[model samples]
Target: MKVKVKVVLKDGILDPQGKAVLHAINDLKFKGVGDVRIGKYIELTFDSLDQSLVENETKEICQKLLANPVIENFDYEIEELT
Candidate 1:
């Protein structure tokens, strides 16, 4: 099984890194770029074929290890491969 986790800042949270990137984009002559938020993606592979179990475990991993859950939100998807 393969799990992909995405962690992103919650709405209304300040993202300095995203702001800097946005400024750089405008400086590079890119227009119409609005608010941008940065996030993280993590991929994990396992031998199990259970999608439900993998999703549950992946959520746990995000809550315990991957994401802070304070100012950030996380979601995950599980893929079973033969």
Candidate 2:
């Protein structure tokens, strides 16, 4: 199975990196760009074919290592690889 995970800062959390990018966007004269939030995208290949197992493992991986449970949120999708 192939898993794709996304880790992002929770709402109400301050993101300085995102703010810097937003500032740069404004400097470049791009109008109407209100917010820019940065996040992490991870791709993992699992040996298990069972979707449920993969899902559980992915969530555990995100919570234990990939994301800061207090300040960040994570979500993942599992796909069967041919």
Candidate 3:
């Protein structure tokens, strides 16, 4: 089984990195670029094929370490590999 996690800052949170990127984009003469946001993408492979177990563990992993409940949010997708 494989799990892919994406962690991103919550709405209304200030993203300094994103802002910097946006400013650079504007300076580069890129028009119509309104905003920019950055996030994390993680991939995990599990030996077990149990969907329930994978879901539970992935949820716990994201909640505990992958995402900050205060200013960040996370979501994941599970894929079974044969």
Taking all chains together, each candidate's TM-score versus the true structure is 0.91, 0.92, 0.92
Root-mean-square deviation per candidate = 1.1, 1.0, 1.0
* Residue 56 lDDT in candidate 1: 78
- Candidate 3, residue 67: CA error in Å? 0.6
Model 3: per-residue Cα lDDT over 28-60, one tens digit each: 999999999999999989999999999999999
The pairs that clash in candidate 3 are none
Alpha-carbon runs more than 4 Å astray in model 1: none
Clashing pairs in 1: none
- lDDT value, candidate 1, whole model: 0.88
Query: What tens digits encode model 1's per-residue C-alpha lDDT throughout 1-82?
Result: 8888899999999999999999999999988999789999999997877777777788888999899988999988777776
Of the two candidates 1 and 3, the one with more favorable lDDT, higher being better, is 3
* Per-candidate clashes, comma-separated: 0, 0, 0
- lDDT for model 2: 0.93
| Error of model 1, residue 26, in angstroms | 0.2
Instruction: Give candidate 2's error at residue 75 in angstroms.
Output: 0.8
The list of candidate 2 runs beyond 4 A from truth reads none
Candidate 1 clashes: the total is: 0
Residue 33 accuracy (lDDT) in model 3? 94
Ranking by lDDT: 3, 2, 1
